[model samples]
Target: MSQAADLPAEAPSARVLVDFDRVDLAYDDTGGNAIEDVSLTIREGEFVAVVGPSGCGKSTFMKLVSGLRPPSEGTVIVDGREVSGPIKIVGMAFQAPTLLPWRTAMDNLMLPLEIVEPYRSNLKQNRAEYEARARGLLKTVGLEGNEDKFPWQLSGGMQQRASICRALIHEPKLLLLDEPFGALDAFTREELWCVLRDLWMEKRFTVILVTHDLREATFLADTVYVMSRRPGRILVRKSIELPRPRDLEITYEERFTDIVLELREHIGRIRKA
Candidate 1:
């Protein structure tokens, strides 16, 4: 892992990277807002998690941040700019790995660079450099020596690791994840948590994770936002103050369990309401 000094000197929390002010999003077919009066600020490099009842617009929030959906009202600002269309500075991964079946793991990781700007133009000239980067990222996620294998050849966890690497290969300023680990087995999911943790600690990019798992939120997020049922609203914003470079062992501690229970209670109340 790279030392902290390898990154910029600025404090990771020093700048506000995402701002949602009284935001509301409504679907015409649904005839009501999916998200309402949602207001929150996410600082640069902060790990934020959104948790709520099944239809509480947690995924809707991801869409807004990534510029996939426009708000019906209020502004959605990211990296100091009001989003007008799909922004280029964000990367996303979902519950599915979504790697191309025909492409090798290395080729899957290179897909974004082939489509996204600057790199796309320079790809032919910098192919070697990009391949080296892909290899490094694969190694980081324990996919070393598996670069030439096709997606179908890799395990579920390995495929997801490649999926995450593909999202990150572009080095975006913001990473949006919607239940990225929801499909994996419990042990693999926890292992990947540490993988993500190390990557974030090393790179200091902003992350917005939407998940149903309270323990995942509590264990990985700097702050966890609990939303109300439908027409979602921010019900609670709980900051996890546990020490950094968190280990899997911390999840077993009393403080960790308490925080998870608290988040669970908030969701339980929303579900019952």
Candidate 2:
């Protein structure tokens, strides 16, 4: 993984933002639980990465955070409020771009505004303003001038950028990214990392990224949590002490590799356990 230089100094205060207390989740009508005894707190505007082996409920955790799923036990609170159904404050992008084939890049970016509130009710009255917002977000993600193209016409990376734009169009306070770059090649994935990093730096949204890529987590997160296999208990919590405003070149440095290796060891231990 290549990283940028000019590491950022750590922020002074680490106040809590999202809190998970002894949380346990099991799908309705399913006999088994997906996550158990999960407890962690993410600081406001913090970048937290959750990494684990496959089927360790990393995606399930995303659902919980976004209030898409209710816990069978324990509590999930964001900003001191308990999370109920479908939090309006969350923006999500997933493994696949999942952009509608029928919509052009700009239209796809405007999808959320068509459904989510404040904008939903005013979409007709505020179409011009909304379109302008989507256009700005597209440019930020390097999707400039591709707005008129349909999803099929854009490359996978371009489509993913549009998807992220759709997610952020409403400007939610929390961003839930579930392996959004998993389908991309290494080069494209790194490129998107910088895209996401710059967006996060500028927006300061609380982000909880669920991924299996240790290097990706190291490069983009303020803190990384490793989960054990199966029940998906959080087994390790490692603070990435590296300086921020990180670029792609920093990933090649000794410090970056050290953190990745340390996380690799923790995940290896979980696999063996």
Candidate 3:
């Protein structure tokens, strides 16, 4: 199988933001590894994607970065610090959106500010300021007028946009998206690709997205890491050399199709293995 390590130094020489050194994870003491020999570097402000088939430990990789699970072997470090527990500097959005049904879009975005701290501790004292930030974020994601609407009131696309806003409200250095667009319809999902692309262009926060969609990975990530089937590890790290800010139009180009096909070929091998 192809390997990312064989590729040129795709990551920048600036201070490494995330460093995984031959990492491995196992849930049960006697069970096999979920992921093994996974070492990679994610630089500051880079957008990276991790892709693999179902049950291939892609989600487990996210948990390891978030400090939700400890690696059974090797080091998992972020921003120069080994992730020992839940790191406050990381923000996450998932496939479900998981917005509180009772809250409005604006409230949902501000939820992070109320939960993650110094903002959390001072939320009450700075409610107006936080509300303004939420409103601005909503506007940025094209949910300006929908701020007062409940999650049920928004379409799948809008809700996902709000979820991303919530993740960014805390201004976390790293944003972890675990299949954030997986549940949307194809059209809506593509629309969100633009939404996310715009947001990332504006914010430039480091991102590590976990998804099964090769198209999504190619369009969004600066570097795409394909994982092997369980006992997963980084199989390929294809740097997306596409120019940005990339638009939906770029997706139709021959170059785009070639990259997707190349990645699909790798996945085909992983599945067969």
Candidate 4:
């Protein structure tokens, strides 16, 4: 059967890049589902954030999207195809920078090209081109002067920034961020949020960010989905209607706070349930 046959006819005809239809995941042969009845769709170039209480499967959701784990039931589709296993179309960044401490920032960014195909095979031949590309990405993320520095030489924010550059170096169609800035100081954390916002605005890659921070979700996502407690399900899908080119100043405004509060209420209700 065709993909269209999998859904109701009344559904909008917009292009959907990621679709999870009543998905579920189990860790063992007879274990209970980690997440159940999961269904959501994300379109190309859409910036989406997933927020939830602790142990609510927010990270599990990211894993499902990236094909890091197969669903015990239901379909996991992306870029118009079902995800059976890990695919090259995804770029992932976790809470820790996870950069190779021995390598320079520029070298770290180029790491993906060494592991991925086509680029990996041609890395030697395209040395200059790839180096330039790495340099360009470094510059884009404000890492120009520190490209030669090792991971430890960079601050937490800078290392995370480098991690993002590394993830994007392959130019994957989808970017998965799992609390990439959660470990940073408050000032640094917020600073990286704007950095991320600017990067998303410029690159337009599809993003599925799993974060605990409500304000971060409100500021960065075009649409934020709130998940319930374990066996997680989307409880709310709130669209961030704030205009683009957003700045830190916008976060203090009543409108932004209202949305954050609204999401918080939903979480509180989920917890209470």
- The model with the greatest TM-score is 1
The residue-level lDDT of candidate 3 at 78 comes to 91
Tens digit per residue, CA lDDT, model 2, 7-89: 22354446667899999997676777889999988877888899999999999999898998889899999877999888888
| TM-score, model 2 to reference | 0.94
Decide which is better by TM-score, 1 or 3: 1
Lowest lDDT sum, 10 consecutive residues, model 2, at 1-10
Query: Which runs of model 2 end up more than 4 angstroms from their true locations?
Result: 1-15, 28-30
C-alpha lDDT of candidate 2 relative to the true structure: 0.87
Ranking by TM-score: 1, 3, 2, 4
Q: Which stretches of candidate 4 lie over 4 Å from their true place?
A: 1-13
lDDT of candidate 3 over 1-273, digit per residue (tens): 344452323335466789999999987975999999999988888889999889999999999999999899999999889999998898999999899998888888887787788998999999998888888889988897898999999988898999999999989999999999999999999988888888888888899999999999999988899999988988888888888778888889999989999999999988887
User: Clash pairs of candidate 1?
Assistant: none
Model 3 ranges off by over 4 Å: 1-13
Ranking, lDDT, top scorer first: 1, 3, 2, 4
Q: What local lDDT score does residue 91 receive in model 4, on the 0 to 100 scale? A: 92
TM-score of 1: 0.95
In candidate 3, which residue pairs get closer than 3 Å at backbone N, Cα or C atoms, i.e. clash? Answer: none
* Native-referenced Cα lDDT, model 4: 0.87
